[model samples]
Target: MKKVNQFASSKHILALAAIAAGIALPPQAVMASQITHVVQQAGAVKGTVVDSKGEPIIGATIKVKGDAKNGTITDLDGNFTLNVKPGTEIEISYIGYKNQVVKAGSSPIKVMMQDDSQSLNEVVVVGFGTQKKVNLTGSVGLATSKDIESRPVGSAVQALQGVVPGLNIDTGNYGGDLNASKSISIRGTGTLDSNQSKGDPLILIDGMEGDLNAINPQDIESISVLKDAAASSIYGSRAPFGVILVTTKSGKAGRVQVNYNTNLRWNTPLNMPDMMNSHQYATFFDQAEFNGSGNHLYGDEERKKIWDYMTGASDVFVEEGSGGKWNYDHTYANIDWLNQYFKHNSFSQEHNASISGGSDKVTFYASGNYLSQGGFLRYGTDNSERFNFTGKINAKLSKYVTVGYNARWTRKNYSRPTTVTGDNFYSHVLRRARPVRAMYDPNGYLMSDINYIDAL
Candidate 1:
C-alpha cells in the first residue's frame, strides 16, 4: 500500500510537469477538443431550391430547424444564403410544394421540392364558414378578384355578368343610364309575388348585409354564390332565393405595401333607333289615314313642303318661340333629335388606393375608391359620383384566438333632369322628341320645357 500511494503521487507530478512543459493532452481530451472545434463550425450556408422538374422555385422559405425567427426567403433566382451552424438541419417550405429538411454543410446545397397534392385543394366560403370545395355538398360558384379586376365596369354586378350560372342581373328598364337600377335574381323568380318576394338573393359582404354595387371590385378577394337551398340553409328565410358571399382582402404579415390604380373609359350606346325624316313621316301617315278613313291627315301642299324641306331644297329657318314655348312647322323641319340630344360617348374614370402591412401579432388594411361617371346626355345635368372606403384590422390575442374589426362606408350621388310624373327619362325623350320637330327657334330660343328632353 505505501508503494502504490508513492507511485500515484509520482504519476500526478509527472502529468503536471508534462502539462506545464506544453505536452499534448491524453486521447479523451483530444477527442473533446475535436468535438468543440466541430461545434464552432458556424457560417453562411448557401442553397438553391428547385421543383421536381428542376425548375427554380422562387420565394421558397428556408428556416433553421425549430427556429422560426432565423429564416430567409429565396430570391428571384431561387437562391438563399442563411447564417447557420454547419451540419445543422434546415426546413425548406413553399406553398403547393412538399416540405424538405436537409443538413447544412460547407458545400452548397440543392433542395428538390415535390408537389403537395393536399395544398392544391381549393377553399370556398359557405354560409356557415369556409370549407374545401371537394367536401362541399351544396352548389356553390366561386369568382376570385382576378376574374373581375380587369373588367372596366362600374358595379360589381356588372363585373359578375355571365360569370356565374343562374345569377341573373338586369339593368331594369333604364338601360345605358349611369345610375340605372339593377334587378338581381338568383336562379329564377320562383314566386309570383314580385312586390313582396322579388326573388332578390341575399348579398352579404364580410358577413354583413351590403349592396353588391357599393363594394369596390379591387377590394374583393372572392365571391361565393350559394345557389341551392342546402348551401343557404344557415341564413334561414332571408336566403330563400339564394345568397352571395363576398370576402374582402386582408393584410398579411409582411412589409408595408401601397398600391394605386386608375382607369379612364368611354361608354357608347349600342342600340339607337333610326328614325325617318319629315317627308317619309308625312307620306306614311297620310297614306295610312287615307286608307283607314278615305281621307288624308296631311294635304298635298304639306306633303310637298315636307319633301322639299327634307331634301335640302329649302333653307329658310322659320321658328317662333320664347324660351321653350316655340311652335315650328313640323312639315318643313327634318331633324334628328336623338343625335342632337345624346353624346357619342360618355366619359368615366375610377381611382383606387390601398395600403396594407403588419407584424405577426397584428395586421391592418385600408382602401379608398372614387368614381366619376358621365351620362349620355349632351347638355343636361346628368352624371354620377361614387366613393368607397374600407378598413380592417386583426390581432392575435392567444394561440387559438383572434379578434378583428372591419368597417366600410359608401356614398353615391346622381344628378339628372326630372321628367314628368309617371314618365321616365328614356320613354319621355322618345315620345316627346320627334324627328319632324326643331329643338331651337329662329330666334335661338329653346323649343321644349324642362320636363321634356327636347329642351337640350
Candidate 2:
C-alpha cells in the first residue's frame, strides 16, 4: 500500500511540473485546466436541407457555429443527416445553390429549397407571406389589367379570358349581363356535368372577398391565378376550383393632383339573322305550325286580315270587323325580328374624377363615376337602367395601427316582353303556324288552344 501511494504522488508531481513548464494541451484541454471556454451549438434540424428542385443535395457544406464536430458535408443524393439543438442556426451552401440559413424547429424539418438560379429569381407566397417567384415549385399564372383593357366586356371577370392558359370562358347566354361575367374554370371541368362543373374561381378584390364586376376596368391593377393545388392550398377547400387574386389601384406617394377621364362608345351588331320571305312564311307557317298550344286558331281569311292590318295594306283591319290575317302584312317584312330586339345604335357615356395625396403618416384617394346607357330593346320588357356610386378611404393611424373604409351603392332595373311567337319575339314579327291556325276566330283570342306557344 505505501508503494502504491508513492507512485500516485510521483504522477501528480509530474503533471504539475509539466503544467508549470507552459506545456499546453489541445483546445478542449486548454479550457478545463483552469482555462476559460468557448463552444458553438448546431441550430439546424437534420435532413431538412434540400435543393431548389426539392431534391436532396448530397455533400453540401453545412456548418453551425465554430464547432468542427457540428459541421459536415451532405451525403450522396443531396441528403443530409444532421443533429442540432433547438435555437441553433445552421447555414447550408452548395456549389450551384444559394446559401440557406435555418434555425432548428421543435420537430424535424422538411425544407423546400431553391437553387441559386431560381433562389434569386423565384418567389412564393406562403401563408400570409410572399417569397420570390422563381423560388416556387408549383404552377401559377399572372397578368396585369393592361393585358385585358382593350376588350369590351360587361364584367371585369371576363377580362381574364386567354390571359391565363388553363382558364376557359364559355359561351354566355345572359345578353349584356353587365353585373356579372360568363363562367370561368381554371382546372378544367371538375365534374361529369360540364355546365355545372365550371365553378367560379375564388375572386379576391384588393384582399377582400367580392365580385369582380364591382370594379371598373380603369381601377384594376393586377390579376394572379392560383391554378395548382400547392399554389391555392392556403385557401383550403374554398379553392377547389381555383383562386383569382385581383388588386385595385391605390394612392401613390406624390403631390396631390386631380384627374379626369371621359369615355363615349357606340356599338353595332357583328352578325345579322336571315330575313323571312312572305311566300316561305305562307308555306312554312302551314308546315311548322306551332299548332298553338292554346285552343285558339285563326283561319286563312283571319290570317290575311291580320297580315293586312299589320302591313297597313287594307285601311287597317279592325279587331271587331277584321276577320283579317293576324300577321300577313308587309310590315312584317320591314321588321327584322332578330334586329328588332336590338337598337340600330347604342350610346354609352362615362365620366370619372378623383383627387389623391399623401405623406409619411398617411395617404388616401377618392373618386366618383357617372354612367348612362340607352338599351336597344323595348321598354317595360328587355330594357336596362343603372346608377352606381362607390367610396374608399385608407389611413395609417399610428406606428402600429392601420384602418380602411369602403362603401358602394347601385340602382338598376330591366324590362320584360311578352310574345306569342316564343323566341321569334326576339326579332320577327312573324310566327310559323299550322293550316288550322286560320280557323281561330278574331279578337286576338284563340278558337283552339293548339295555335298558341307557351312563354319561354
Candidate 3:
C-alpha cells in the first residue's frame, strides 16, 4: 500500500511539472498568434485632404505617427487610403498648409487644413543667430528679393535706395557713370571722431565681406539692416555704425530650372547747362579783354585786326615783318563745341542666366551675368563691361551632417578718355570747355591752340 501511494505521488509531481512547462511554452506562441491576427485585422483608413477653402489638396502626404516607412501620398482626387491599427493617429501634411492629426475610426476622415502664415512672417537672421520676427526686440529692417527684382539696376545697393528709413544710400552721378557705386550710411553718422575715421556701415554678403556692387541683384535672396545697439552689438566693434546682412539665393529641391533675363536701358542727361553760342561768346571775350586792358594800349591797326577776327568777317591774318607773313584762316568759322562734346543718348544692356537643380541629397545653383554700360561722353572711349559668375553647392553627408560650398568671380573693365583725370570728366572738361573756339581748323586738322577750348 505504501509503495502504491509513493508511485501515485511521483506521477502527480511529474504531471504538475509537465503542465507548468506546457503553460510556459504556449504563452509565447499564443502571444505571437495574437499579434499576427491584429496585424491582419488592421483597418483601412480613407481620408481626403483640402484647404481652408475646401479645395482638394492633391499630393498631400498621409503618414503614421513616428513611422516614416509607412506613409502614402494622396491621389489626384485628394483621397488617401492607409492601413493602420484601430485608434492609430495619422498625420496629414501639405506644403503651405498646417499639419493635421486625426485618429483612425469607423468614419471616413475629412481634413481641412488652414494656410500656414507663420512661414510668411519668417525668421530673421541676427548677428549671433536667427530669431522669429515677432520675437525680435531690436530695430530691424527687412527687404526681400521681390522688392528689388523688378528694377533694372547694375548694383545691388541701388535697389535699396529709398526702401529703408534712416538708411541713406548715395549713388553719386548715376546718369552716365557706369562705375558709380552706392555709399550707405545708417541713421546719419555714427561717430564724430574725425581722427578715428568716420564709421561706415558694415556690409556682409553671405557672411563674407564683399562689395555691394559686386553682388548681382538677381542672386540676392534677402537683406536685413540691423540698426541700434541691441540689433548689432553681437558683432562687437564691427557693429558700431550698423550692419547690412545680405543673403544669396540657394538651390531648391525639385526639377531642374533655367532662367534667362535681359534688360536694355537708354540714358539721357537731365541737367546740362545751356551755354552761350560761339558768336555771343566771342563778343563776351572781346568785351572782357577791353575791360582788362585799356582799349588805348593797342594800336588802331591791332585793334581793328582783333575786332575783325572776333566778328568772323575775315579768314586771313597778316603780320608785319621784313617779309610780309600771313598766319591763320577761319572762314567757315562758327562751331558749337557743346554739341560735339556730349551724346544725345547712351544705351546699356544686361544679360543674366541661371540654372538651379537638386536631389534629396545634393543641390546646386549656377549663374552668369553680363553687363555693358555706355557713358555719356561723345568723344574718345567711355564705357564699362562686367562679367560675373556664381556657383553654390550643398550636400547632405549624413542625417545630421551637411556641407556647403560657394564661389563667386567678377571681372569689370572700365574705359574712359585718357585726357580725363580721375573721373573728373564732367566737372573739369564739360563745365570748363568753351564754345567760342572750333574743334577743328578749316583744313580738318585738330586745333592745338584755341584760348576758349584748348584743354580738349
Candidate 4:
C-alpha cells in the first residue's frame, strides 16, 4: 500500500513539471530538429543572364569571388546557379556585360543579368573554348542544326559536309567488308600510320572524344569547326586534319515541351534513254550478227527473214530458192525489257518524337526516331531501317553538389551493294533479246561480260 501511494505521488509531480516546461519553451524549440534545420537552411542563386531584349547570352562567365576554382559558364539558356559557402560573394561578368556582385542567404536568389556592353552576336565557342567574338583570336565556323537535318546519315561528320570548308568526307570502298561506312577527313591532309592522306577530322563532343552520328541532330544545339592550323593547334597530334566540336541539346527551365517532326518523300527516275522498239530491235540484232566479230549463229536466209520483219515488213523471206510460209517477226517481249526491271517511283518516310521539361531541382530530356527508306536501284535493294534514342537527367543535390547522366543507343540496317552488281542486270533489262531467248547457251552463259568494258 505504501509503495503504490509513493508511485502515484511521483507521477503527478512529473506531469506538473512537463506542463511547466512546455509552456516556458519557445515555439521553435518545441518543433522537430529537421523542421528547424530546414527553416535556417541557405537557398540557391539562379538567374538567366540575357541581353536587353531577353535573349540568353549562352557561354557567358560566372564566378565565385576570389575563387578561380569556383566558376562556371552559362549554358545556352543563360542560366546558372552558384552554391557559395552560405554567405560567399559572387561576381558575374561577361566580355560585354557589366559585372555584378551579390551575397547569398538561406533562400535561393534570382537575378536577371542584363547586358549592354557586348554586341549580341559577338560571342561563340572557339577552339580554346567558349569565348566572346571580340575576344576570339582563332578561325572558327559556326553551323546551325537546321541547315543539315534533311539527310539521314550514319555519322556526324557526314552531316557537316559543305558547311565547314576544308573538311573532306568520303565513304571509301568498304575496304574488305561491304557493310563498312564512309571515312571522315578534315582539310584533306595528313598521312600518319597510313600511306594514304585520307585522315579523318578530330571530333570533340562537349570537349570530349565522341562520334557525331551517335547524337540525334534534333538534340544538337550547334557545331563549331576549327579549320585553320593555328586555330586547331590545341588538338596537337590529332589536329593535323583539323577539329570539329559539336554541342548537344540541353533542357530549358519552363513548362515541358512536346515536339513532333514528320516528313515523307518520293524519288522519281529521270534521264533514261529511249530504247528501240520490237522492229528496230530485230534489225539491230541482225546487224549485230552480220558485222559482229564472232561467227554468225544463223544463215543468210534467216538473216533476211529477220531483217524484213524489223523494217516493218516482217515477212518470212526464205531465200529466192526456198519455198514455205517462212516469215520471221520480232517478238514483243524483247522491246520493253528496260521498263520491266526498274521501278518508276519509290518512297521514304521519317518520324520523330521528343519530350523535355524541368523543375527547380531537376531537368530531363528524351527523344526517339524511326525511319524507313527505299532505294532507286533496279533490283529492290537500297532499302534502309533505323531506330535511335537519347535521354538525359540533371539533379541538383545541394548548393555545391550535382549529379547528371546521359545515354544514347541506336540500331540500323541499310542496303547498298545493288549498284556494283553490274552487267547481268543491264543485259537482262537493256538487251534486245526476247523472253524466249535462253539466258545461257551450251558453253557458259552466252552474254559477254561487261566488267572489263568500264575498266579501260
Candidate 5:
C-alpha cells in the first residue's frame, strides 16, 4: 500500500512540474485548439480572372501554388472558388497570357492577367481533331497556304511535289498532258515495285474523300500529312499507307474582306533527247543492221542521198506516183520529229478570288478559281480549262450549339486529237514517228501516213 501511494505521488509531482513549465493542457482545451485550426484551414478563396482590357477571361485555371491536384477552371463568368489555408499562394494561368500568383487572405480576389509577349504556338490538324504542334507526337508534315499559293501548277498535288519529305508525286508519261492526273505516294513503294504496289495515301479535303486535283490550290488553308500508323489509327484500313488531311479556310469574326490573285506562266521542256540527224541515223542503222544480219540495210547511194538532203543540197521532196497522186520523197527528208511536233513554250494562266466575313453569330467564306492550260503540242488543238467554286457558312445558335454548311463545285474540259494509244500520245509520238518522215509534203499538203493524220 505504501509503494502504490509513493507512485501516485510521483505522478502528481510530474504533472505539477509540467503545469509550471506551461507544457501541460486539459484534454478538452487541446481538442478545441485543433478544431479552431481545422476551421481556419477550411476557409474558401473566391477569385475572378480578367484580361488587361477588363474583359472576363473564361476557362482560366486557378490552383494552389504548389498543388496541381487542387485546381479549378474559371466558369463562363470568369469566377472560380477554391478552398485553401490562410496566407496560401494561388496561381492563375491561361493560354497566350502571363501567369499570376497571389496570396489567399481575403474572401474575394481579382486577378488581371497580362498578355504574354511570345507568339502563340501553331495548331496542327491531327486524325480527327486539332492539337498544338509542340504537343503533337508521331510523324507528320504540315504545309500552309503560303507554301503552295504562289506555285504555278494546275493540280494541288503538283504544287506539293518537293514541298513535303517522304511524299512522292509523279507525273511520269503524262507530264505533258495538261489535264492528266498525277500519282501520289508516301515513303516510297516499300518492299514492292511501284507498278505492283497499291500504296496510295488517302487524301481528305474538309473531311470528305475528294480528289486532290479537283480542289483549287488557292482554296486550301492547310495540309497535314500523317505518316505513321499510330497517328492515323482513326482512319483504319483507308490509311494503310498514309493520310493527307486538308483543311479549307474559314471566316473569322471581323469586317468583310475580299482578296483576288492571278498568275500567268510559261512552260518549256527543260531537256529533250538529242536525236540523230538523217546522216547519223543512216550510219547507225547501217551499222546495227550489218552487225545483226551481216548485211547493210542502206547502200552507199542511200547514205549519200541522206547526207545531201541533210546538207539542204537537194530540194526534191515529192514525186508524182503512177496513179496521178503526189508521194513524199522518202530519201529527201531529215525532219526533227520532236521539234516538229512539240512547242518550245506553252502558256498557262490561273485566277482566284475570295470573300470572307463574320459577325458574332454568323460567318461565311466563298471562293472561285479559274485555270486555263495549253499543251506542248505544236499542231492541233490541245487545251484544258478548269473551274472551281466553294462556299461555307457557320452560325452560332447558342453557347453550346453551332451549325455549318459547305458546298463545292468543279468543272473541267480538255480537247485533243485522237492518238494510236489511249492518252499516251507523247510516247507514241516519240516512238512511232521517224526522223526521216516530214510533217507535210512539198505541196504543203498533210502527210499521207496514218500517224501524221492522227497527230494532226
Candidate 6:
C-alpha cells in the first residue's frame, strides 16, 4: 500500500510539473508571436510627390489615412519616408494642387497631384460668412482691385462702370461739381416713384453705410455687386435697388511694404457754342426794331454808329436823355465771352500713398490720398480739393477669435465764382453776356457799368 501511494504521488507531481512548464512556455511564445506580428505589419513607405507636369513638389504634406497626427513633409527632392502599417492609405496635399491618396505597400509609391481649378473649392465672401463660389445660386459679380487699378478716376464708383453686366453707371454730371457721384442702377430703375430722393442702390463699405466715392480706389480690395433678390435680401428694406459690397485692402502677414501712386489728367471741352459777333448782333436788333415799329427805329444814324463802333471809327456815346453822358471806346475789342470765362483745358491730379505690414498676431494698414481738380472756368475760382485717410488694425486674440478696427476720415473743399449759383455760371450768366458790350473801358480797368458784360 505504501509503494502504491508513493507511485500515485510521483504521478501527481509529474502532472503538476507538466502543467507549470506549459504555462511558462505559452507566455513567452505568445509574447514573441505578438512582436513578430507587429513587426510584419509595420513598414517604411517611400515615395515622391510630383505635379501634373511631373515636377517635384517640395513641402508637400503626406499623412497616413485615419491617422491625421502622423504626417511628414516632402524634402527638397520631393521625397518622403513614413513608418506606417502595410496596406494603410496615405494622403498627399499641397497648395494649389489637388489631394491624392495611395495605399502603402512594399513597392515605392509615387503620388501625382493635379491642379485644382474648380470653383467649387473656391471660398467667397457671403453675408456673414464665407461660402464656396460654386454653391452660390444668386446673381453676384466680383471685381478685384487689380481689375480697376489701371483706371484713373477720382471716385471708386467710376471704376465700376462697364465692369459688370446688368449694372448701369452714369456719370453725366461728372466734373460739373466737386461732390458729384456717379449714378448707379442695377438692372434698370428699381422704382418708378419720380422722386429724386429714392431709387438709389445701397452702398456698404466694410459693413458700414458709406458713399462709394468716399473710399479711395487705391484702397479697394474687392467689390461684389448683389444683383438679385436672393443675394440682396439679407439687407432687408435697404436693398430694394441692389447692394454694393466694398471690401478695402488689409495688411497681410509678411514683410512691410510701401506703395505710392499718382495720376495726372487733362480735360478739354468737347463742344462750344458759336455766338453772334457785334455786327451780327446790331443787324439783328435793327431788323427786329424795324419790324416792331412801323418806322425805321435807328434809321441811318444808328446804323452808322454801330458800323463806326465796330470799325474803330468812333467811341460809343450815350446821349444825356438816355442815362448820362457815358463814353465807351470798344473799337479794337472783339472779345469772346466764352473764351474769356472758360479755359480750353483743365488739369487734375491725384496722389496716394500706403504703408502695410503684419505679423502672425497683428496687422496694420494706413493710407492717405490727395486729389486736386480744376474746372473749365477761368474767370471764377472753380476748383476742388480732397483729402482722405484710412487706418486699419487687426489682431488675433486666439486661434478661433479675432478683433479688428477701421477708421476713415475725408475732407473736401470746393470754390467757385461768387456769382455762380448751383453750377449755372456758364449756362446762365456767361452765355447771356451780350457781344456788343465791352469787358473793360478804355482805361483797361473793369467796366462795372457794362450791364450785359459785367458778369465777366
lDDT of 3 at 125: 76
Q: What total of clashing residue pairs does each candidate reach? A: 0, 64, 0, 11, 0, 0
Residue 187 accuracy (lDDT) in model 2: 68
Candidate 1 deviant stretches above 4 angstroms: 1-120, 317-331, 420-422, 448-454
Provide C-alpha RMSD values for all models, in order: 19.1, 19.0, 21.6, 25.0, 16.8, 21.2
Model 1, span 1-456: residue lDDT tens: 566556545545655676789875454333322222233234988878889999977667788999999887774346777878898999999887889999999998999998886633778999788998868888888888999898989989899999988888888766767777677888877679887768888899999998898888989999999999885568998988888999999999999999999999988889888877777877887899999999988798777766777777876434345565444544267778777777889999999999999999999999999999998877768899999999999999999999999999899999887752125645776665556665566666675443353445
| Highest-scoring model, lDDT | 1
Candidate lDDT scores, in order, read: 0.79, 0.56, 0.73, 0.60, 0.79, 0.75
Q: Can you give the TM-score per candidate against the true fold?
A: 0.70, 0.55, 0.64, 0.53, 0.70, 0.66
Error of 6 at 43 (Å): 52
Report the C-alpha lDDT of model 6 over 301-359, residue by residue, as the tens digit. Answer: 65666667778898762322235523443222445677777789999999999999999
For model 5, how does the per-residue alpha-carbon lDDT over 304-363 read when each residue is reduced to its tens digit? 777777788876544566567665444446878777777899999999999999999999
Off by over 4 Å in 6: 1-124, 130-133, 172-175, 284-333, 423-428, 451-456
List, residue by residue over 1-456, the lDDT tens digit for candidate 2: 566556545545654665688854333222222111111125435554576567765456667865657666653334444566777877777677667777767666565556557544544333355556766666667666577666554346667777778987764664453322467777677667766654667887767788765566556667777787874568887777777777666666679878787777886655555765333455455555546453323346656754664466864433332354454222222233344345676676766677777776667666666655555553333434554555666788888897877665655654455552235554333344322223234455433433222222
- Give the 10-residue window scoring lowest on summed lDDT in candidate 1: 32-41
Q: Is candidate 2 or candidate 5 better by lDDT?
A: 5
lDDT of prediction 3: 0.73
